[model samples]
Target: MKPAHSEFPAPPAQLDHDNCRGVASILSRVGDKWSVLVIMMLFNGPKRFNEIKRLIGSISQRMLTLTLRGLERDGLVTRTVFPTIPPRVDYELTDLGRGLSKPVIALGTWAMDHMEQIEAARAHFDQRNDTA
Candidate 1:
């Protein structure tokens, strides 16, 4: 007994160029700022929840929870829980997540190399668009 909305519209099994475009749209979900930071932190090794919180500084508890959940759902990150007097949790990048590191690192490098130029372009664009 499945509800209509509950079912997912998966990309068709037939190999097609459009399938690649559809997957790109899906990847955008995990490519946001917080998700990228979470993956970068795990690029070194596995880390505990609090450790990741400290590493990412400014992220609120709620946001960290949400971002981790999304990444986990996408199989980009894995969460482990240990049974003990006090429950413990840890997160790490899966192999797919690790695969994204190179591209993310390249983006970081590009940002560093072009930041000044980008800022200048933004200033010019803003000035050109200003009504006043």
Candidate 2:
């Protein structure tokens, strides 16, 4: 049994070419694993490029650079250059980027809270399929 709203519409939500393409484009960018992590890291405050890499640990230098560039292009992150002995650069979230943080943090919290349940469900599904 399902509530009225729980059931999908007859044809489901619109999946016209333009709609699908637009959604996929954005999802491909922000929905990437590294993008999410990078966005989360910048939520605290502006961080140097190296600082972000060190904190995120597993991400490679190339990937981080790409992520930052993409975010900057999307107008979600601002890159600042400080004139000093050598040079210094920092990345901070823009207003739009900060707006993105709220939902991302909520999602991260939900994943942490439900991890055990998700793992249990995975195990159950695997066992059932194994026996089939």
Candidate 3:
């Protein structure tokens, strides 16, 4: 008797388990509120620590430091130092970070355009679930 064969095809080896982890790292980099704002401000070229804080309006020093450190760790932002009477540091986007601006702006615009519809859908879904 002949044995039956399976019909499903296997996936390419390129679809590796690490893909999700890599995506998660990217999302995590751009996903935080401070990270998004910091990158946006860098769109105007490099800025000193206090200058960024002034433009962002109310970000605390600690939070800004943490966010900048994280961005630096991700290789998206660079920190520069100058030797003078007082040390100075400035932050600017790396090529990769600059490339991210278009995507981030697109996402922000989409959210603004569709937020009302999305909220309405969420309310309707919540009401239906409550009635059920």
Candidate 4:
């Protein structure tokens, strides 16, 4: 009997033009630095706009607004507004976004673990190239 994982399609060896374009489009969204940071910020739980901005530290107000809107448009996040004396808003990951967190977190951990090795490799490569 085939393994359970066999039910899923294997990674494409070569993507056709349309498939390549689709992959690039999605990567341009989720692979962006700000989007990755925003997704990480929302991974824990809901947070307000200013709170997300504060946590990310260097993102401008306008840029944060745009990032949230893009994530929401992609169905990866949801925005909620509370009716209070002064209105309050919260941003949270959707089910899809939550599903994405596992891989994102794993990738982050892998990067942290391998950072020193990666830097050493880069330095070695640069030294070789510089002296060539």
Per-residue lDDT of model 2, residues 14-126, tens digit only: 67999889878988888888888989999999999999999999999999999999999988899999998688999999999999989888888899999999999999999
Enumerate clash totals for all models, in the order shown. 0, 0, 0, 0
How do the residues 61-108 of candidate 3 rate in per-residue lDDT, one tens digit apiece?
A: 999999999999998899999886699999999998899877777777
Ranking of all predicted structures according to TM-score, beginning with the best and ending with the worst: 2, 4, 1, 3
Whole-model Cα lDDT of every candidate shown, in order: 0.86, 0.92, 0.88, 0.92
User: For candidate 1, lDDT tens digit of each residue in 49-121?
Assistant: 8898999998999999999999899888899998976988889889998998778877777888999999999
Clashing pairs in 4: none
Residue 2 error for model 4, in Å? 23
Best model number under TM-score: 2
Q: Which has the better TM-score: candidate 1, or candidate 3? A: 1
CA shift at 111, candidate 4, in angstroms?
0.9
Model 4 CA deviation exceeding 4 Å by range? 1-9
The clash tally of candidate 3 reads 0
Worst 10 residues of 4 by lDDT: 2-11
